[model samples]
Structures are given as C-alpha cells and as structure tokens.
Target: MNPKKLKVLSLVLASLLFISCDKPEKPAEKKIELPKPASMLTLVPDDTIFFAGGLEPVPLKEWTQWSITHFNLSKEMFNPQEIQKLREEAKTDGQRLALQIWEDYLATLLALDTQFASWGFAEKPQLASYAIGLAPVLLRINLQDVQRFNTKIAELEEKAKVKAKVETLGTATFRRYALNEQEPLAHLIIGVDGNDAVFMIDVGIESQQTLALALGQSKPEKSLAQGNRLKSLQENYKLLASSLVYLDHQQILTGLTTKDGNRMAKMVQQLASKLKEENKGWLNELHSEGCRKDLQTMGANWPQTVFGYTAFDVKAKPSKVDALMVVESKDKPLLEGLKSLRGFVPYYSKEAVFAPAVFSFGLGLSVENVGPFLMKQWTEITQKQYSCSFLKEMQTDLQAKNPAAVGFATSMASGVRGLSLSLLSLSLEKKEGMATPMPKELEAVVSLSAKDPAALVQTVAAMVPQLATLQIPADGTPVQLPLPMPLPFTPMAAINGSHLTVYAGAKAEQLAKEMGKMSLESSQGFLASSLDYGKYYGLIGDVVASVDKKEGQQQATPQMLSMFEAMKQAKVRVQTKLDFTERGLEMTMDMTSPE
Candidate 1:
C-alpha cells in the first residue's frame, strides 16, 4: 500500500464524516393573514326624553299662580279721573295709564272665582292665568266707553221698537236685544204688508242700513229709500247712534286681531327659537370640549329629537302631573335622531314566518333574565324567534361576562349526561332555529366540582370531537372490553351506576376466537386488549342506539308492561319506605332491542 493511496482514503473518510455532522437547513414558514372584521355601531335612544323634568307640561294651577303673581292687578284697575289726568300728564305717563287701563280691562272676568268653583271647574286657574297674563298687551282701548256705547244702543233699540212696526228677517229674527223695557209702549203690530213692509222690517226700522245690510235679506241701497219712513229715520237717527257704538267696540277689541296678538306671539316664538339655538350651541361645545367632561357634570347624555312623537309626563306618585309635553318628529331622520341620542339601550327581536332567518341584537350590558324583565316593564315588547346563530353568539358573549355559576356536583351531572339528561330531568326543550344536532354517540357528565358549570359544559362540548378515537392496550386476556365510558352513566343501564356490561353470548364467543389467532405472547395480549376495547365500544353504541330509539315509543305507550310494572312497584315500595314524606323523587326507565 502506497502512502499517497492511504492519504487519499483518509481524506475520503473525513469528507464522509463532515457530511454526516452537518444538518439540513429548513425553509421559513409563511404567515397567515386573517380578514378584517366588519365595522359595528350600537345606537341607543335618549333617556332624558322619557325621564327629564322640563320636558313635561306645566300644571294649570301653577301656570295660573305664576301669571297672577307676576302682574300687579290693583295698580292696573281703571280710574275715571286717571283718564282726564292722563291728558295733562307727560307722553310717557299717558302711555303708562293707557297700558294700565288695558291690563285691568283685559283681566276683568264676567264670572267670579266662587262661580268658577261652583261650576266644578278643574282648569279654572289655567284659563284665568292665561287671560290675566296676556291682558296688558291684549287690551289697548278703553273698555268702559265701549260698554257705555253698547248700553245706549240697547236703549235706542227699545225706543224704536215701541215707535214702529219692526219685523226682522232671516235668522236675525231669532236674535234677541237687551231692551230697557220688556213690553212695547204702543200696541204691537205683526203683519207682512207687502214688499216695502218686508224691506222696512229687514232694515230694523230705525237701524243704520250701512250696518243693517249685513243683517238684511236684500241688497241694500247706498241712498235712503223714498217714502219709506223707517229707512229715512234710520239714515238720520239710527245710523249716527249705531256708528258710535261700532267704533267704540272696534277700538277696544283691536288687540284681539292678528296684528296685535302677533306681536306677543312673536316674543314667545323668539324665546322658543333662542332656546333651540342655545341647545345646539351647547351640543357643539360639548362635542369640541370632550363628552366625558360634559357627562361628568350633566350626569347623563343630553336629550335629542327621535322617531315618532315623544311625550313626557312628570308627576309624583299619588298626585297630578306638573307638566306634560308632546313632541313630534318626521321620517327616518327622526329615527336617526333617536339613535344619536344617548343613555338608553335598544333591543330589537324579529320573527319571520317563512324566511330562512331572523336577526336580533343587544345594545348594552344585559342579564340572562333580562328577557322577562323587559317584557314585564313593557308588555308590548314581544318575544320573537331569531336565527340560532345570532342567539348563540349573543348568549356566548353574555355568558362570558356573567357565566351561570352552577355548583360542582350539578355541573358534573349535567356535563356527563349532556343535553339528554338536561332535556329529560330539567325538561329543557330544544330551542327553535338550532342548526346543530346534539352528538348522539358521545355523552359526557361533568362532576359538579367544575367552575362555571354552564360554561364548562359548553366549553367541553365545543372542544371534544363527537366521534370516539380508539386506542389498543398492549396487555390483556381475550375478554370483551366494556364500551367507552359515558361521562355520566345512565343509572338504569349501568351496573350499580359504575361499571358497564360489554359482551353478549355470540359476541363474546367471536371475540375469544379472534384472540386465539395471534402469534407472539405480546401480540396475543395486545389482540386480547383490543377485543375488550372493541366489545365495550360496540356495547356502548348499541345501548345508546337502543335508548334513542325506544325513548319516544315508551313515552307514547300507555300499556302497563313489565318494565312499567317494575317501576310502579319500586315507586310504591320507595314511597312506603319513606312514609310518603319525600318530594321531587323522579325515575325514568327505558328498554329497547334491535328489530
């Protein structure tokens, strides 16, 4: 062997060693990107609109009292000397006198407070207050002069009736006059003496035809009728008298017209406008100044106009309300306004007759028991069937925050038994709209020791696969394996509510035969264990299937069969043993075989 040849061989060996020592480089993992979630908004209604004080209507008595106290009535009372003195007074003083007279006259009521009380009037205070409060601006002319003119007109009307044959026309004939004398001074004459006579009566004999035309049946002439004594007398005498009265009354009632009333009305309208403007400005300031700061001082969110009409009623219990209001808004903007308002949560539950789904949502923290609470508060709120997914999600979120904390034993029992036990024992009905069917093959029971029983059950159900995963043991005799244990045992099927029976006659023989075919002792042992596992698994499946199939049939049957007979006997014996003192002892038994 040459030295060069040895060195070459050594180099080849070292190269092989180096190659074995190095590890392969791995590729980098790609990152997975999840889709962005949808934007969500929870809009609530304003609470102030429902509960605020100022939004309510003012009480009648309060309004009346306020009006009376604000106006000094004694100072406003009329004095005949004041009018004469007013002329000599300065312009400002005269104006003050005029205003005072106006106020006093307007405040004067034909009826007294005692009369109002006798009538059993409830809104008397409100009516009187409104009239008095508005009197100063409402009455501007002298009412005394107007009243005097009216009195004189009544006197002349009585005198004319006695002097002439007065026949009235149309509905005006039904109208009565306050004549100074009840009876005529002369002999009464009643007759339709042709067209000229009818025209005379229509003109009220000594009445001003200018004013009488409005009352007359025919078109009135601007000039006096010739040879018609009544028309001529009215033009010369009645016209002048009636005109004076008309002028006086018109001057006093001028304040009642649209022009005069509108001035005061404008002030009120301006006040309302200013209030709204101030509210808007405050809202803008709140937005800019940070809502938290405003909320701290205000205690809650501000009221805003919302959907439909908003009405407020503020009253202490056992007493009449102080104020009441009715606010109306229109269209979808009203709904938007309601949503923009704050301090209230909104919930909507919808049910569809034929659609594939329905939807519902909650806007705030809610209790599991809130469904009944809301319904109790507002009977109009109705229960509705919604999409199962929607309800499940809502329940999930709610339960996470406020889990239904069940005792350990109760939770364990519920979990092991699964929904079946819950359905049977608690009589919980299957909720409508649930798309997922409960896993029939795998039943679990959790011990009551678990924390948050409802959540634990739900968590386990969600985590575990419904299908069973089989694992073979390495050591065992060729005996039947029991079924995989259900978390909660069915007491009726279980042997003393602990162990499960696995093999029947034929299945037992078959399992033993399969175990005999294994070669090595280890293989033989593994085969035996596998047989037991298989047998237990098969038995569990059979028992579950039998229970599922027979439960409904047995429930429907009315016959007193062997199983039922045994149950009845047991019940009697148990009752007799306990002396019938026990309450809520329930037992259910089911038996089934394959067809």
Candidate 2:
C-alpha cells in the first residue's frame, strides 16, 4: 500500500547524504604569535628613562652593503690591481694599514653570513654632580658567533698595535679602552657573557654597584621586559614592527628637577649651589622651586613617546619603510590646539610632490585660526605670571609686545593656508673648460593657498607699491611682477579663488597657469616632501666642480668623483609625510633604490 511513498522517501534521503558529503567541515582559524622585545631587556632596570630594541633579526650583510655603497667601496677597491695601486699611493704607514684593514673587514663579511640577534640600550645611572659631562650608558648586543668575533677583534688589535687593557669585576672580565688618560670615567668597556656583549661607557670601578647591575649578577627590583608597559606596546604593534623605541619624558624632567630620591637631581642642586657661589645668577634661576613647578606643568603635556615600524619591505625592487610614532598625551585642549594646525591640502600639492624634481616640500596649516591660536598662547604665558625669574622676564616682555603680535597675526597675509617650495629643474652651462659654470636652465616655484586670495594679494600689493599698479586679476591669470633689480628668471604671480602662486624660471608662467586650475583637495596631512637622489647628486657635482675651478683647480678630488659614480648606480628616491591620527602624530618615510 506504501511502496511509492517509501521509494520517494529513500530518494530524498539519498540526495541529503550526497550534499552533506560534498560540504567539508569548517577549518579552524590559526592565531599568529607575535615577536617580543629583546630577552636582554629583562636585565634593564625599571628606572631606565629610555629604551630601544629590535624584535626581528637583521642580517649583518645589510649594514655592510649599505656602508660599502655609501662610502664608494666597490668590489674593484678590494681587487688585486686596485689594492696594489692604493698601497703605492699611500702617503704614510697609517694610511696603508687603514686601507688593508678595511679590505680585510669586507672579505670577512663575505665569509661570515650570520645575522644579528636581539639588542637594546638601557640608560645607566650617573655618579657625579657636574653640570656637563657624558651620561652613563649601557648597551647589550648578542653575537651570532662569539669565537669568530673575538678572533677578528684580536687580529685587528694586533694589526693596529693598540691593545685594550683587560680588567675584571667579580667574575666578569672586560677589555677597556681609555678614551681620556686624565678622566677615570672616560673609557669604553666591552665584556662578553656567553653570546651577549655588554658595553659600558663613562662607567668607572668606583661604581661597583652599577658594574654589578650591568653585568646581570645583581637583578633589578623591576625590569622593563617584565613590565606591562612593554607588553602592551608589543601587543598593540603586533606583527607591524621589527623594532621599537620608548621614551619617558616625564621621568626625565622629574629626575632633573626633583631634589629627593634622585642622585642626578641632587647633583644638579650641588652644581647650582657651586654656580651661585661663583655669582652665576642666570644659571641659578633654574634651581629655584618656581622653575621646577613650571617644568613639571610643561612635562605633563606629553608623558611618554612610543615609536615602531609599521611596514619594512627591504626585498622590494626599491626598499620601503612606514613608521608610526605616538606621543602619549591626555590633555584635550593641547591636543585640539595641535590638531587645528593642519589645514586643507589641495590635490595639486601631491602632484607637485611626485613631479620630477631635485627637491620639493609642501606644508599645510589652518591659516584662518593660526593668528588667534598664537595670540591665545602668548596671552596664557603672560597671564600665568610665572614666578620663575627667567619666565617672569619672558612674561613681562610678552605683555608689552602682545598688542603688536595680535595685529600681525590677524592681518590678511595670515589667511594663507598652504605653502609649497620646489626646485623643479637645474642644469649647468655646457661650455667646455669654463671656470664657473653658470646655471643654464633653472626653475623654482613657491605656491601659496589662502581663504581669501583677493584680500591677500591686496595686502601684499600695499607693501610693494609696484604690485598695486598692475591690478592683478582674481581669475587664475598669470601676471609678471616688476622688480627694481634684474633677476635670472622672470617672476610671475597668479591668483584664483583659493590659491596664490608665484614662480621663477623659464616655465614660470606655464606652471602658474597649471597651479591656478588645480581644483582637487589634498588628502588630510600637515606636511609632505619628496627628493630624487640622482638629480640632487648631479646638482651637487656641478657645484663641487665650480668650487674647485674657483680655487684654481682643474678637477674635483678623487673622493668626490668616486662618490658621484656610486650615487649614479644607486638612483634612490625618498618621500615622507606627517599627519595626525587616533594613534597620535604619525610620520612615514619611504626610501627606494633602483635594481
């Protein structure tokens, strides 16, 4: 009675089974584990005000290759023919030995292909009360091969005939090179612990506790690596950085001003007292309690700064870098004031940045409010009536000059919002054997933007009466400016609804016209710059040639010539920008070279 029904149900179940088999189980997501700061950071004391560490390992060859290229030390320099020529040309034994050592070092770099391990610097406590002296420093870097490094060092020492004195502190032994015979604290000390090399500068045996602390025999009560600050930084910048830098601005200011619980502060007080005894009234102003409080107030604006690389692509056709720097601040008014400084950047500004040029820079500023902002700051300083003697004087002067400052800030010229400076083109004359090669072709432009272009031109014209007579148009039209003195290139000016541009060179009028038509608004940022190294070096070479000729020389020195040759091979380009974001003021730089 149900045969048909049973067959239909079986067919439906078969189809469901086939669908389930085709659909695979959802794969589990994999979490990425981020790298941490250098292990040696754990030994750094909590009192350390500044620290910088690398999270990713960098090959030693990277540094060597850069040095080789920058110094024009090519493979040919190490070849047998060049080596013989260099030796024969050496004027002294010192020169010959130095050349040989550099060649040996380069050869060694080829054989040793090891990479650098984690490294960091931790500021050490100073033991003196002098107003000026080298600050104590401690740095630790791990060696990939201690034996090979030590062997190379030994060879260098033997060749130079200058030996470092061996000294011991507890169980740790170090090689010390005295930088100054009269100063006990001025020495470069290097100690090896396993694969880690501990370096100390301006530290003496008198600082036994410091020596022990640096050697890691005595553990600090609190360490940077074990702290939540570094942990938080690592977590926030996870996978985005190969290195990180931390600065404690508040701690530094406090340590300098506080009289209690800080040896450096105490030393500062003692120095201040000695200066007072010598009748140094100017230096004594800083030692007063009023100055300390003023300094503390200023320091509260920015307590700390953190920096790291967001992108580092060295393997690209041209290497690129993007970094982020954060100033940890909670003062809302101060932040708002700083943020207000950024103005409307037009799209043409970016065109100017990327356009082929020796050098170019663009800066954006909120022109409308800058005058009021500056006036407000000056008023605050004067109204505060600071008790510090030096500050009191400043306050008095500002109170007297505030009226004039207000007038200047509120002037029509202050309405300008953006500025761009560029050296568009440059070339030397082609005349053979000329003593001074005059610029045959040169172009430069300075473009300005304003809230009221007509008002700005009127204000400028009032100052330069000659400009008033021309009656410059407001329809983005270019007008040649009359000058009392002759110029190498024609001076041109143009004004649109928002932009006022000035130009000099053969193409000044054309560039001004193009600038007038620029209508696209630029992306938000305060500053941007671009440079072409190949063009820059070419200009520099011409200058050097001119200078040599003026000094009665026919050609530039060999070193200068070699540098020009190397620069031609690299053909590097660089661009940079500065902007404000939720993360804080961010600056990015990109550097690339041709393959």
Q: Pick the candidate with the highest TM-score.
A: 2
The residue-by-residue lDDT of candidate 2 on 1-595, one tens digit each, is 1343223223322322221111111111223221233455556666566655543433323433443443334443344555555545544323333444445545543343331111111111001101111223344544545665566545655764556666676666666554333323344455665455565543343355555666656666666656666557757864242355667776677666666424345444544554436675554566578887887777787677876555555456645545567777766665677677786554433433334567777888866666676777777778885767777887888777765555465565566677877777877764577666676666877777776777877887789877778666788767887889864667787785577877777564465566565542544458887777767776777677565354576677666666665554545566677776555666766555554
The number of clashing residue pairs in each candidate reads 22, 2
How well does candidate 1 match the true structure, expressed as C-alpha RMSD? 41.6
Candidate 2, residue 489: how far the Cα is off, in Å: 7.4
Segments of candidate 1 deviating more than 4 angstroms: 1-98, 101-319, 344-595
Cα lDDT of model 1 by residue, 1-595, tens digit: 2343223223322322221111111121223121111100000011101111111111322323322232212222334454445333313221232233232223332123432122222221101000111111010011112233333323433433322233455533312221112121111111121111110111112233311332333332221122232233224222211010001111122212222232222222333344556564532332232332323222222122111111111122211111111122222332332322111111111111111011111121112223333333232212322223333354455444422242322333331210101011111122245332233322211111111233443454466655123222222222222345642223121111111112223322232233223221111000000011122333333333333224345321222222232222211000000000011111111111111
Return the top candidate by lDDT: 2
* lDDT, candidates in the order shown: 0.22, 0.56
How much is 91 displaced in model 1, in angstroms?
A: 5.7
In model 1, what lDDT does residue 237 have?
29
